[model samples]
Target chain A: MTLLNAIDPWLAGPRSAELLFPTLALPVLGLLLAPLLGARWARLLALASLVVGLVLALACTAALVAADAPLVYALGGWAAPLGVELRLDGPAALMLLLTAVLLLLIGLHAAGEFSVRAAGRRATLAFWTLLLGVWAGLDGLFLGRDLFNLYVAIEVLTFSAVPMVCLKGHAAQFQAAFQYLLFALLGSALYLLGAGLMLGVHGTLDIAQIRVALDAVATHPPDIGGDARAATLAAVALMSTGLLAKTALMPLHLWLPPAHGGAPAPASAVLSALVVKGSFFLLFRLWLDLVPDLPQLHVGLLLGGLGVFAILLGNLMALMQARLKLLVAYSTLAQIGYLFLLFPLASGASGGPAATAALIQVVSHALAKASLFLLAGRILVAFGHDRLPALDGFGRAMPATLLVILMAGLALVGLPPSGGYLVKSLYASAAADLGAWWWPPALELGGLLSAAYLARILSIALSPAPASGTGTGAAAGGGHILRAPITGLAAPALLAVCALLLGLLPPALFSVMDVARPGMGSATAVAGVMLSALTPSGFWRSAGPVLTVALVVVLFHSAGESAWGRRIASIGRGVAGFEGWLRQWRTAGALLLLFLLIQVWTSIG
Target chain B: MNEAQLYGVCGAGLVGIGLYGAILGRSTLRRLLAFNLVGSGVFLIFGAIARRGGLAGGAQSDPVPQALVITGLVVAFAATALAVALLIRLATVAHEAASAAATPGSTDDPSTPATASQGRGERGPGHVGAGHS
Candidate 1:
């Protein structure tokens, strides 16, 4: 009876219940229809489903806003601990809307790439089917209220994403895909083990029920026995470790760059921008909602410490990459690091600023990274290769694409009036409120590193073409012109602009971050923090990183002539060597176990 | 010891062995089989948990974990099938690359040499030794 009442607080009127079912169902329907219909019709069906999915997501957001509460729907009127439940809140709605918008635009771009007449019948059919499958999996992850159900959702996401990595069927791609599959399989296995442990201890798979049970155990430990706490902590530790591996946090990120870089452009865009976020969203939910009262401060610090390493090492690795796609892929490794900072920052009294900052960072990075990847695809098509050094004077050939890269780079570097700038300020303020003063300097250094790499690409791009009439030998000999479809360029251009303009959004709109967790961040607080960025002092703070980037670029340009340049080059090679050593299968696997052990020790201690 | 406790210990041992093999397996195929061992261990734990639930109260066994184990089994089976398919595809692709390298007239594919060099450059000699073995 108490368990029944425990669910009462979460039982809201299902105002948007109708909207939730279709968001998941529409994608499944499209995937199902793709095979029955031929290739051309399947592409149309896929696009149609995404458009409808977007509308459904918007309607869900509207319904949630109107009700001012999360919408929870029980499957077949059977309540939790028995039947499944789907919960829709502010964060989930925001992710739904973001996924819908990105997928639709990427779908439009994909329509041209995978057109029946161009990529052949089989590949076209496969791409559409896999895209919709990924959409359904992401939607499932966002809405699932049962921990076991969420595990299934993540598996769905992994299976669908792995095949897309090797769609080209090349040997290198096959190797990348194989490694990706192995890591993901290991992750899910551990996750399943943890879920089983939780079920054994809690007697329920529903997240709400487990939380209620945990609270009960906390209040009256004798009722459930002392071992329950240890079991619960161990279970949470295992689950978190599994999620970290799946999210590819720093040391666990060995599989990401190659898998993401080797995929087709549209696939890379989706993988980098959305697929990784599914596991991250689950991790956030586990820490914040499921085990908020547990002794996790040390765990948070461990994760934040890892974030620092990922930012420094990933950016350094990106700076050394000779291929445009791999550079962008390594940049993803760095951006993922920023997401982990939320754990430590939010662990303090004020979770509001950190939560809002992390949300903004996720949305903006998704947009910018997707745009950069699509643009990389455009460059590949125009030059017959994406080798960075050979891309000199590409700006002259594809001015619009270069412009898009600049906009995306601005967001990546967190320049003023961009989402990156807003996130950095919020992070600094959050760290200040927590009295953790070291984070602001780390964020600034990370921004500077990002700027150094972007400057490398832009400087090379803007350099003059050689005396011959060609920029790249491949482009010159192959006669590949710089003509790309308008949709290909326009789609990425729109996404990059959105990333830059994210900061300009009204502060009141960010109240969604506080939606189920009301004290997380208020509108006024967010407004004040955002407004501070526009101040003269804030403007100067933002300018400092830009100036440092300029200096780094100048140093790099004169590197061949100076002794300082040689020293910096040697350091770069050393970082690359360290990264190479870390990426070995045995090393990464050993690190996974070591991280799991550390996570367990922290949680239990 | 009680049956449930005994099974639980066995499950934990299986998990430890599976983790070791999955991490240090010499080939992708071995790793896939090791993953299956881990899945079996997890399922065994679930079964033991159900038995413990039965000893604690209402029914002969808790139906929920049983139901969960079934779903988990399906997922694991699907995962194995997919991994196997990918392994076969990888083998075929490697064979093709090796044969193409051996053949004299197969230089029509411009991407072959570039891919070969890129693989060597990216993995380094150390990785080639550890990864492909």
Candidate 2:
């Protein structure tokens, strides 16, 4: 059928069927060929699929933006209300294109790190196939208009993702993978329960139909049965809470660090960058698209509160980490916290600038986190360990990698001319506009916390090698230890550049984000507020937090290195203590039930 | 209450019990069983809905929910298989660690804190959080 369509110009022109190129066809083909393909060939095929997927995603984006409406394709030509539909709108296109680009870059990097000839044929094949599977799942998640179909996509994502965590076959890695699997299963079960409840009430699992039904029901005030209202609230709470666990939001994020930290570099990159976003994309669908005016202010606040905790606590944990990969994993947790700001910000102004800021945060974090993890992988390999203290003088050995890290760190710290900066400013302004007077400072504090953690790593990496002849490269005594592969360094460097340069792009680039967008009118006003932050005074106001964080890092470093040891260790213990308490299955379960109860109470009360 | 309503309540009760067991159980296998219990409960609710809703004359139950429940069962089976595989691997790993720890001279490479705590054979309930410690 694809071949036939390819030959027929009229049938082939910008059809919604093109969306499947990345989501289904590529993964299926990858799985089929994985057994026969060698490592090198598998890498090539991955690269090819990613490039083709990127082009297809761009085409869909262009077509959707040009049409200024969602592109909905009915499978077997059975329209919604009967058969499943695939949809590509502004947000879905953006996420799809982002996933393709990240996968392609990560694929290139993985080629260097996971050489088929070096890591055994089976390992290479498994890694590439799993990578492709994650891509396929993410693409489906972005485009899927049906809740049940999205659930299936998430399952594919989880099944593919869990193995990647235990690729090393280490005892610890196995534990992490097992924990990850259990958490995902628990989360998905809850999500399915919600979907089942929705189906029982609405009789259709299609989001579009549910939206229409809810709208029709909303028009009749007294006709709204209390039971239906409670059911909808329970359903929303169940669905989003399930997604929160998968997205690794705080209180539900205990499984993320170990699993993400244990994975191979490319796998970690894919897990951190794209896999988490899959659940988040669905949360977006539920909040912005499906139930925009649900009148669940308390739910929004609860989510925002969790986001705040994730940011602060995630950053604190990242700062406390002695190892590089764990540090990056915790940083991902914090960045996820930043993403949650959208819920509360969106609560105030419908279709406001907050959603756009959240979108920017998603894209920016995806690029930065992928770049950091890849670079961290390179550092891990070059130094033979990822311990923070062991990273001393590594900058001297691999200056290129250090530069990539620095650029990525700057993005993470929300410094100017980086997408993270734009995201922070936009979020701050959104909070200010919401009259939540407290949020702007919290936003600034998060940036400061981010700077403190990033600075901790950069400062350590920049310091001279320890006096003892213990550092990896410096003490090797060989005038020429093997250098990092060009392929490995190049990909992270390129991704870092992309993350750094993203903020410099024209505002017009964001126009595509408006299609099928939830709210209206307030967006332009919010955009104006965000653009004003680019002015000199606005820039200074925003830059103040970054400067303060820099001074704090410097002052902390100036205090005898011995002083930092005790203070940091105490902080570490406190953070770890709380985290340990939360990590217990019993506590996590209790919290999950508590959140559900609170959500149901808020909606009903 | 009608037959479907009774089934729905039964499903809800199963879910509550499963939730408690899954949360409280210490052993991995027990939790896995609890997860299956929850899945069963959810599937039962879906079955009940299908039976109650699809009474357009000749049908016994709605084919859609029936089909979905079947798919759900398949997914749940796959999940169970995966969990069991993990549990087997974990048991082997624990056994190996215990053996390695008993042999004193084998403690040369405490490459990570987690492995070190694992080597001590006293990883206890706090062992899981040692990776980043």
What's the TM-score of every candidate structure?
A: 0.94, 0.92
Evaluated on CA atoms against the true complex, candidate 2 attains a DockQ of 0.34
Q: Please, what are the lDDT tens digits per residue for candidate 1 over residues A50-159?
A: 99999888878777776787887777788897887889888888899999999999989878888888889888888888899899999999999899999999998999
Candidate 2, chain B, TM-score (2 decimals): 0.79
Model 1: docking quality category? acceptable
Score candidate 1 by TM-score against the native: 0.94
> Please, what are the lDDT tens digits per residue for candidate 2 over residues A1-605?
98756634422355645454445566657766765776668877877888888877777777776667787777778876567778877878889889988998888777756776678776877788888878878877987888888898899899889888877666777778888888888889899999888888888889988888777776667456556656776887888878888998988876787788878888899999889988988887887777747435567788888889988888887877778888899899999998888887785324466778888888989999999999888776666668776566666677777788888877877776677877777776667777777766666777788888777776676676656665343522323345676766777888788888776676677777777765633345435555766688877876787777877885675465676678877767767777767766677778888887887676556
The lDDT, on a scale of 0 to 1, for candidate 1 is 0.81
Second chain TM-score, each model: 0.80, 0.79
Please report the candidate that would top DockQ against the real structure: 1
Q: Which RMSD values do the candidates have, in order?
A: 4.8, 4.0
Q: How many clashing pairs per prediction, in order?
A: 1, 1
Candidate models: Cα lDDT each: 0.81, 0.76
